[model samples]
Target: MFVDLLIGGIFAMSLLPLTTGYCAYSYGRSFWLWFALGVFLPIVSYFILFALILRQQLDHGQRLLTEAKAILAEAEEAERVQREER
Candidate 1:
């Protein structure tokens, strides 16, 4: 009975890190690093992963904003040229 309980406990402990590694892999991140982090520092690893995802989103938003500003500037320049011609 004691041996069975020990095996079950080990399985339970390993499951979380495995799941975390899989999540990192699915997100195109480093699987082994997350797995090790999850094993040693589960909560911290999750926070770090979330922060990375948020940073990527922020970068994408900044790129889109820059593109929009450039397009608007081009449109304004064209309008100004049209006014001069008139």
Candidate 2:
């Protein structure tokens, strides 16, 4: 059972190179470092790295999304004002 679990994890990680690569890149680390971790230590490495590091990158993404919404709101308001003046 234990061996099966580890094998399953390795297989799962094999399918997630892009996600692992993204995490590595987002953390300003080496892609091969994470790719090897996923390939070798699958479950533990992903949980440890992603759980700790992903939140900061996700927060950055959220901030950018918020800024984009603000910019869109400003543009829409300007459009409304221009229409009102006409």
Global CA lDDT of candidate 2, please? 0.77
The Cα RMSD of model 1 versus the native structure comes to: 11.9
Kindly list the per-residue Cα lDDT of model 2 for residues 4-80, writing each as its tens digit: 99999877758766567678776667888887877777677778777767575479886687679789999999999
Q: Give the residue spans of candidate 1 off by over 4 A.
A: 61-86
Tell me the tens digit of each residue's lDDT in model 1 across 29-62. 8899899998998778878887876776589786
User: What TM-score would each prediction reach against the true structure?
Assistant: 0.59, 0.43
Clashes of each: 0, 0
Model 2 Cα displacement at 41 (Å)? 0.8
Q: Pick by TM-score: which candidate is best? A: 1
